[model samples]
Target chain A: MLISSAQGAVRAADTLITANWLDYLLIAIYFAFVLGIGFMARRQVSDSIDFFLSGRSLPAWVTGLAFISANLGAVEIMGMSATGAQMGLPTVHYFWVGAIPAMLFLGVVMMPFYYGSKVRSVPEFMLRRFGPGAHLVNSLSFALAQLLIAGVNLYLLASIVHALLGWPMWTALIVAAVIVLSYITLGGLSAAIYNEVLQFFVIVASLLPLTLIGLHRVGGYGGLKDKITAAAANNDKITPAKDQLESWPGLPLSGFDSPLLSVIGIVFGLGFVLSFGYWTTNFVEVQRAMASNSISAARKTPIIGAFPKMFVPFIVILPGMVAAVLVNEIVQLKASGGEAAIPGGASGDVKYNDALLLLMRDVLPNGLLGLAIAGLLAAFMAGMAANISAFNTVFSYDLWQTYVQKDKPDHYYLGIGRLATFAATVVAIFTATIAGKFGNIMDYLQTLFGFFNAPLFATFILGMFWKRMTATAGWMGLVAGTLSAIAVWSAGEFGKAFELSGQGLAFVAASTAFVVDIVVSVVVSLMTAPKPEGSLKGLVYSETPKEDLIDPHEASLPFFQRTVPLALIALAMVLVLNVIF
Target chain B: MSHTPERYDAEDARDDVREDVADAGTDTGSGRHTAGAFDIRNIIGALLSIYGLILTLASFVGDQSLDKTGGVRANLWTGLALLAAGLAFMAWAKAKPIVVPDHIPHDDDRPAGH
Candidate 1:
């Protein structure tokens, strides 16, 4: 195939890969490894909590690894890379400012209530306090969120395979989905958690080496710095610049005035909304927290989870920036009538995905490439496994028995959970196949997931704070929030009534739903005969503690004393970096 | 009136049973309290339920530019207060000291036998 005309930057990558066998071997090996792990863990899978929630036996560290691993899907690696390719360093704020704080708060604050309440799923908690309606809304919202999220994860996995091995996108997606589903189906959450831990390590090993080498290849660290500095020197960098510039400090467009309100809106809306939503509502990761053996263990899990998240940006994002500098230079070379070889269209979505591929093919040499490929594969497996396991668990517990066979046997329910896992995987495969056709599938999937997330998280949070939030009001608020998000998206996509904003819209919709739900639920709860706060003990843990509950400071006193100071120290480091850089 | 040794032994047995059930690997006894000791799903869920609580407060604070604008000290303080409260709720799952319900219907009473 003829290289694209504007193939200035990818010329180096274009010439290097004459050997197809190596790519196939790499992918096959990657597949075998992940499936093998799943098979091995399958033995440990029990029918009840062990299979569903890892027997709640995982200590802090393993739980921590599984937690981080589960979060590491193709969405983050590719999405953040695309962001980094455009945005630069300020995007790191997504972790330091947004995720870390949330995780820390979740660890120190949220763990006790959940641990004490002894609920299985977050929605199950809602049902005990509110009613069946609350549980239904929560479970449905979660299922929807996981549904789209699974497709997106598969799509990213497929893109990498397609780019590396020249497999058809759909072919790659099917293969990826089947491999992931086979093991995930076999092992359930136990295998998923165990495999996730392994995948986390593999991804780190794969990316870190490539990142270091890539930096070195681009004229060492010093040379690399000069290249990006030159790129930034171009004032025209604004339009085609990476997606994250709005958050970069001292970058001409940091917040509100940036070309799009997306960044500012995310900062204002999503920083809080998504953090709380994912932390509280998303059961996939929180299930790991729930599976912790002790209250103290659960409390420490989020904190431990936060530390890796702090570093992940550097591992994934920095290399993309390096690749951007390299790719842009190639474009400049081609502009001069040089035989510049680019693999795909430069500056488009395809090239954005290909940029990382190009970097890997070009920079990673022998055994190292195998390792790096393994990392990508690890990311692929871990991400997919997390989604599949969570979906299966929710489907089995929340949907299958709850709706289909309310009085099924334990063995029967376990069988159903396994069946649900298979069904969920099938749905994902079909969805990813359809989603694959869309060029900017990653971006679209995230926004759509955000739409589903905005309302449910908002209602659940409000129900806790406001005593008056009745079940009827929660249902109303959930409907309102989801509809509000849909209305925003619909107006932007279908009606063209208003310009479609990005992350900001999700935030606004989520916020509006939360506010409205509280208002309506409170009014209705109070106006209609109020239910006496009966059996609301373990259900709602507002500001006051039950008598036996130890003060958190006293309960995990030793850990808290050290962690608080340590967190402050890290905060200081970030502040210092801001000042210096 | 309730000082029987058998009663104390029975209470101990029940505690052991509860702990055993908590770790009941796949044993979903009819009355099994899946809600474990460290279950923060609700608290986290609740805080998360109120989406953007902190962000909303942060916006108002930033809008007033209280640090920069010199708004009424109370507005500044209130913003600070809301921020702290929001952070506290989001951070400490046990921030809301939930009193374990006084009346947990016995699993024996429930139709499902644990």
Candidate 2:
């Protein structure tokens, strides 16, 4: 699968976009700044804390942008645009319904416990609240997950390099891996965070122009809508034009025959369980919030990110929708049931993944094309760096320091972290090959989230709220929850029992994992002996004082600067968007 | 607070005072040398400005390719916008620089328990 895809990518490379010296210059300049920032950040890393968590000294704005940009990987950008092309406006749910509320919850409710306790990583928090059993389970699983997901990002990154410069697959993989490895090992989390902020702007600068030009080509919003309606009339496989244009009760995107079941699945499975599981508990994003300077800044990081996140669909999804109408290849693919042979390329079929590339080739001129390519590079690096940094922190602080060398000096652990970063990047190159076997990367990603994050969120939320939850229950619930999600996924994949596939099956699996984990936790808690109340201070919600969870200084600040007000405003704005679309 | 003994260190108390002073300095619109050598805003501004400058130059000298984008000079417009954004970031950084205390407190001083 990997070899075939590489061959196909090589064949499609020349036809995608031809670049000149100017494009190469822009890319080279971007690389120079990326490395320069890494070198500058290295000077600040004096201790383990600085290497792992930026010393918890960064202001909220920097962490906030990093929080979002770390997530805007090449897979996310391309996958989302592909989703937009296939599902139309309904893709907005992944942002508004699935992401925003969870991010707000993380900011308003969860960050206090995380930041106030001063845990370097999420699994460390698990150790404090639960015990060694759950902490070990969480850390090992988290380390493995980050490596695999890092491979996904690395694979896509290498593919983009190959597509741009026509480099051999192995050569592209090694170069991309080395560049990310250099920055992360040099400056640690600070380097990753700073570059993520820069990448956020570059991503916006590149995608915004593509979106505007694509919209203009389709004759504005009305023209796009008319074209979509006409196309829907001809294509029987697609959802109706009305359903395609609207965001609510999305039947096609959810893969449910009944409207009621579709809405329920979206609301409970995706909106509540999967979204919260990924956003609130996933260490990649929580690591960003945990790096904020103060309690208030920590709480406001995700809220600040929410403001930009809600509007991202306008740039990302709108371009895909415009491409569906404007690009002939995409239209033909959609008409022929999503797989049609390309005219001259060795790639047999033009998938929805080609929508953004096709639109860029069709619309963007030379210089702007270079910027877009740079944006992609920035995104992929940001993603892989987030994974590697998070992995190193867990490996050094949570796993190594906790288990292997308990009394090692701080600098020893820091050295271990740097080594871990280098090792993880090399491992990701091998794992990237594993990622290439899958036809649709999104399904693979969602299933992995089901296995890792969903169960972990259940354990965290239950243990944090209910002090009676025991250490045995903590690990037990995680193990059982993860096993159940896997069982359900296997049944769906092999037995075809769920009558669902793609994201819907992943959703159902996650929801089952969450519910089963919660139930098992509650049952196990009643049977097992709990930790003493005195040890639970600052770990459990009921035992901790209110002051520890809130910044006292925030009382004097204006309403706009406060966490709750900003979160509420963001919530209201997203709701308005849902209604508008 | 048996759970966290490190929160009561004298170093933390001193750093708290420094943080307050630094926060006040930024609030009152006074420039302070906080992470001055490695301010992220400066780096971001510099990169954006260079990209913006190159794109702006390329718009005039490089291929216009009017036929591709339906007769729009995308490079020119995007270049100007990026240049403006880059300048704004630099100005914002100059006006309100982030204040980093010398010793930022790390509250996780408890021993790792197995």
Candidate 2, residues A1-581, lDDT tens digits: the string is: 99987775756566456888888888888999899989877876777877888877777888899999999995568778888888898888889988999999999999999989978889999999888999999999999999999999998888777666777668889999999999999988989999999999999999999999898888889989999999999778766889889988888778888889889988888899899999999999999988777889899999999999998999888988998889898888777767667662112357777688778888999999999999988999999999999999999989999999888778898899989999999999999999877766777888999899898889989888999999999999999999999999999999888788437998999998999999999999999999986999989999999989999989988999899999999999998998899
Instruction: Name the top TM-score candidate.
Output: 2
- The per-residue C-alpha lDDT of model 1 at residue A411 equals 74
Candidate 2 segments exceeding 4 Å error: A1-15, A343-348, B1-34, B99-114
Candidate 2 global lDDT = 0.85
iRMSD of prediction 1: 20.3
Predicted candidate 1 versus true structure: per-residue lDDT over A470-514, tens digit per residue: 777766666666677677666656786654333444455555555
lDDT of each: 0.58, 0.85
Q: List the residue pairs that clash in candidate 2.
A: none
Cα miss at A295, model 2 (Å)? 0.7
Q: Which stretches of candidate 1 lie over 4 Å from their true place?
A: A1-33, A220-222, A232-264, A328-349, A494-504, A543-557, A560-581, B1-114
Question: What is the TM-score (0 to 1) of candidate 2?
Answer: 0.93
